[model samples]
Target chain A: MICLSLFLSFLQIGLFSFGGGYAAMPLIQEQVVTLHGWLSMETFADLVTISEMTPGPIAVNAATFVGTQTAGFAGAVAATLGCVLPSCLFVTLLAFIYTRCRSLPILQQTLASLRPAVVSMIAKAGLTILISAFFLDGTASLIRENISVRMIVWFAAALFLLRKKKWNPILVMALCGICEAAFCAV
Target chain B: MEIFQKKQRLPVLLRLFTSTLYLSAFTFGGGYVIVTLLKNTFVDKYHWISEEEMLDLTAIAQSAPGAVAVNGAAAVGCRIAGIPGVLASVLGAVIPPMAILSLVSLCYTVFCSNPWISAALNGMKAGVGAVITSVVWDMSSRIVRSKDPANTLILILSFCLCWFGGVNVICIILAAAAFGVLRSLHAKKGGSAA
Candidate 1:
């Protein structure tokens, strides 16, 4: 039963989430917190923290954590496989079709329509994560309390450095994390 | 003898292995950062696909399954190479973290209450929050710039529903899908009537 739940939750995450791992957060939050009752909101938040800190996609982190919590190591494998299986299967199939229809106008039109929908899904996922992060308990305390101001400023600075100044991402993330630790201590 | 020519595919495997290492080592800010790196390597550096194709592939990858970064990498690999590419990319993405986590999990049990590690993680949490916020802003600007009122409205509603109302995201996704489909149909019907 635990295995089944892990499979289904990840499968749902795989099918519905658009725009990537961050976009899957709300769906993951819902499944882990509200539906399955496997983890608490606080734990989910903690998982998000770990997921962001660790190297890999958020979905994979969630799968590993949730699977481990529910059914040990095997559960972790089950969840990870469940999450990634869709991508593996879809890409392979799409590859086959793409080769055959690389020049078809009708296929192109269908893909065109699908683009806006994909954009919308990605947008929605972003909104969900923003809300989850900054506006907990139906309040924007993260901003109002000024707890996140410095962090935001540093994040913007990092973004500028990465985009405009062409800095490396690893350096930026490390610097930001260091700055954050310093500020919090002060 | 000519018909049985054995093509050397070792370079492809090496590329896949290296990419996997890069992903596991450098992906700290989650999926979007990985995607950006992928764009740098696959699209800009390698010229595997055009920028437009990359965006389309990203969309499809996000909507498919697994981690978006891994999925995107696999899609690009399959597109550029073949089944071998898929294996190489996925293995590249999954292996490092899996090994690291196994070690961490072992140590974590021993250090569950270590003050230094705990404090470090607490500080890291704040950084994670900041990273997530940056991801949201980056994605929103890239994907939600239409002047369409309906799109704008849906964005606002979805934010409010999830953030304030605490509505289930699965329901919100379904609602958004239905709303988009119905709106598109209505626009088509109105166009025909005119």
Candidate 2:
């Protein structure tokens, strides 16, 4: 029953979410934290961070982590399938039909409108992450007093490399890991 | 419609699986990076999909549900072959994360206890935040450069709604879609890119 519920919840996430991975963060959070009580918001943010470190889709990683935490390996399998299978089925149907009517004006307009909102959703996810990463309580308002210099420095370095220099994210992440570990050791 | 031509059943599936798996494993920056790798292999290397078709597929992938990379692979794979191709592509996209995360989950409990490990994980969280910020900046700039005022307004409204108002994302998106349809209808008369 636990595994089945995990699968069904993630399947709903996979089916309903649009836009990109970050865009799906809120939905993932709502389902896991607010709706099911599977994980707390702090743990969800941690999972999101860990998911960011892992390869593959962020949504997939979250589903796997949450599933495993809740019900071990079989839970992981069930959750992953639930998250991906819906997309697989839906996209196949969409692909078959879309290829036939590629240029419908209505479709084009809808896509154009979606682009901006998608961008905003990603930004919202980023804001939530920044707060959680910096603040102790994971609350946006307490960030001023709870700020950690180490986190801010590492974040700035990552941003410069990623935004300005266009460094490889994997390399940046590895470096950030080493820097953080070293900082913590000292 | 002669794209990618005909291939025997088993080999095409194999090829799709291998290519997608290799691409997903090699890239870590998420959907767009995976999309680029797909383009390089399918469009540039194999000539399996035309450049325009790849763009269309990406758009469709974004507009639809699930991860864009998975959707892209399925859409392109379906175009190249058929149902088998979609299976191969999705499996290829999914397998890497499962394997990688399985290994991570094995250590997750152990890693959670150590303070040093926790610090590193927290630092990595910051890095992830930076990466997401950069991604949003890059994507937002492109849309802004499209010179559509409605795009800018929708973008701002969505951000405010999500950040301050705490409105449900799905509701915001639905509202934006309605706004988009109206914006495009108005643009048709004014004659600008919609």
Q: How close to the true structure is residue B180 of candidate 1, measured as C-alpha lDDT? A: 54
List runs of model 1 lying over 4 Å from the truth: A1-53, A57-59, A62-83, A116-143, A182-186, B1-9, B28-30, B109-194
Best by lDDT: 2
Weakest 10 consecutive residues of candidate 2 chain B by summed lDDT: B1-10
Question: What tens-digit string does per-residue lDDT give for candidate 1 at B1-194?
Answer: 01111364667567756866675666654554455566656665667576546655665565455577777777766766677777788778876666555455445444544445443444333334444445445544644664555555665676677656866544565566566556666766888899
- CA error at residue A173 for candidate 2, angstroms: 2.2
Residue B67 in model 1: shift from native, Å?
3.3
TM-score for all models, in order of appearance: 0.63, 0.68
Write out the backbone clash pairs for model 1.
B20-B92
Candidate 2 stretches greater than 4 Å from native: A1-79, A95-99, A142-144, B1-85, B104-108, B187-194
lDDT of 1 by residue, A9-96 (tens): 8888866666566678999998888999988898787677666546787777788788887888888877777777777888767665
